[model samples]
Target: MPTILLIEDEAALGMIVKDSLEMRGFTVQYAEDGEEGLRLFRAALPDIVVADVMMPRLDGFSLAERIRAENQTVPIIFLTARSQTADVVRGFELGGNDYLKKPFSMDELIVRIKALLGRQPAAPEAPAGPLPIGRYRFDYPKQRLHLDSHAADLSNREAELLKRLYDQRNQVLERTVVLRELWGDDSFFNGRSLDVFITRLRRHVKDDPQVQIINIRGIGYKLVV
Candidate 1:
């Protein structure tokens, strides 16, 4: 049976969801606020997280961001009352795997949960890296950016981009292709956001003498091995 973490502040709704999941043979852990949810998450590391968007101490967006920083493959489902475009966009940007709007049916939630769990393959072993790139070394699965012996934590997007670049080392990755695949969008704002992330990557690898991320003018970026 899969374990699930349910983060919802409403007593009635929380109990209903928790009970429903439990009845379905899933082991469920409940948290009434974002802070406690995060604490519980770190301690237990459940198979999936179902979090409410609006909560005290910390919000769903921030919680999801934090989780993604640690485990990129963990599936997160956001429960939000607001269905605005910006809210949806932000959810995906924060690495949400699924979103459930307010007043959603319990059965629908269960179906979604099952689908997400099914999609996840067994966790892959951490790849050996910190493979010297220029002045920095990236420990891929560890998501650490290191200059010699010192290490820096990378944001989720940063880690994903770095991994992609390294995976296709020396290849020119198209800008549109990267944005659409990683970010789920290729709008002007998203394109600009990609540039910002690229700049950050450059900063991290600036110490490396051999590894360089070069912008190919009108085309894409070349991750020079």
Candidate 2:
């Protein structure tokens, strides 16, 4: 059974969600506002977070930004009524793993939670050494990419994306496959996030002309080294 930190302003809705999750054998830590959610989050970290987009003291986006600053591995799922595309994109940008619109079914939420939890990478064993990538040396353990005298720190997602590309160098890494594996789905928003990471990885290895991560059009990406 996993622990969930649920932050919602509406007391009734929060209680319903909490009760529902508890019935499914999940430990739910319910909070009426973002500030208290953050406090509980710091006190005892949960396996996953389900938070409403709007809150009284601290908004969901702000809370997610803060959480990402501390722990990048925990899964975060945002529940919101805002239907704007920009808001959805902003949620993804702020490190939300998934976004569910208001009036969403508990079954869908539970499925998403289970999918995200199942996809979480297990702790890796000690690495042999920094892996070579053209002129860059990627230290996956430390999430650092070094080139010459300069070193670029990569986020957890960035490191994972780069590692996958490097592992499949010279081959087409299917877009849908990557999306499903990394993001849990091939949704448009997750595709955009993947593009952002690709752009970042390109920037990191730009100093070396011999290494390139090229888009395969509608297919995927190919890392040429």
Candidate 3:
């Protein structure tokens, strides 16, 4: 069973979400503010985190940034009422793995979680050359990534995204090209979602001393190795 750390300012809604997730076989630790959320994160180190963006004290963005700095691979999902492109981009920039708009359905949230958790890309017939993502060896054809003694499975989307970055290593990969190639659209939501995936890719290579994905402000991203 997966343990979820839920950080939301609304007490009533928190309980509801906790109860709902528990019903779905997930253990949950609830925090009503970002400060408490950060404390719980350090103490428990839950599998996935769901946090509200507008909480008092620390705020979700700060909490996610701190969490990312501490743990590169732990997944974070932001829950926010604000749907502006800037806010969504900011959330992704802070290392958010996903986001849910306020007043969302529980079922949709569950599906999103399942998708994020279980997404897998079809393996390639041949490896994508000698690509070393930091300490990890990316076997793009097989959709497998190995780091140290551990291995991580990459979804098709993840692999494709990483492949593109590797192809454009050391320079900016245009945001529009990335979106059109990977997601087939350059809509605001797609852009926001791309940020989440970028965060994930960053986490995958965070341990590598020679690899980094640098955001090019309003333009695109540069993958330096």
Best candidate, TM-score: 2
Clash pairs, candidate 1, are 130-138, 134-208, 134-209, 134-210, 134-211, 135-207, 135-208, 135-209
Displacement of the residue 28 alpha carbon in candidate 2, Å: 1.9
Q: Write the per-residue lDDT of candidate 2 for residues 1-225, one digit (tens) a residue.
A: 899999999999999999999999999999999999999999879999999999999999999999989887677899999968788878877777778889989988997788666545542343689989998899987789998888877765677778788878999999998887767679887787687678777878999999999999999999999
Off by over 4 Å in 1: 1-3, 10-27, 42-50, 61-78, 81-129, 155-158, 175-203, 206-221
> TM-score-based ranking, best first?
2, 3, 1
Instruction: Supply the global lDDT for candidate 2.
Output: 0.85
Error of 1 at 162 (Å): 1.8
**For model 3, what is the C-alpha lDDT against the true structure?**
0.80
Positional deviation of residue 220's Cα in model 3 after best superposition, in angstroms = 13
Candidate 3 wrong stretches, greater than 4 Å = 119-136, 139-160, 163-187, 195-225
Span of ten consecutive residues with least summed lDDT in model 2? 118-127
Residue 1 lDDT in candidate 2? 80
Ranked by lDDT, top first: 2, 3, 1
Highest lDDT scorer? 2
Better of 2 and 3 by TM-score: 2
In terms of lDDT, the poorest run of 10 residues in model 1 is 117-126
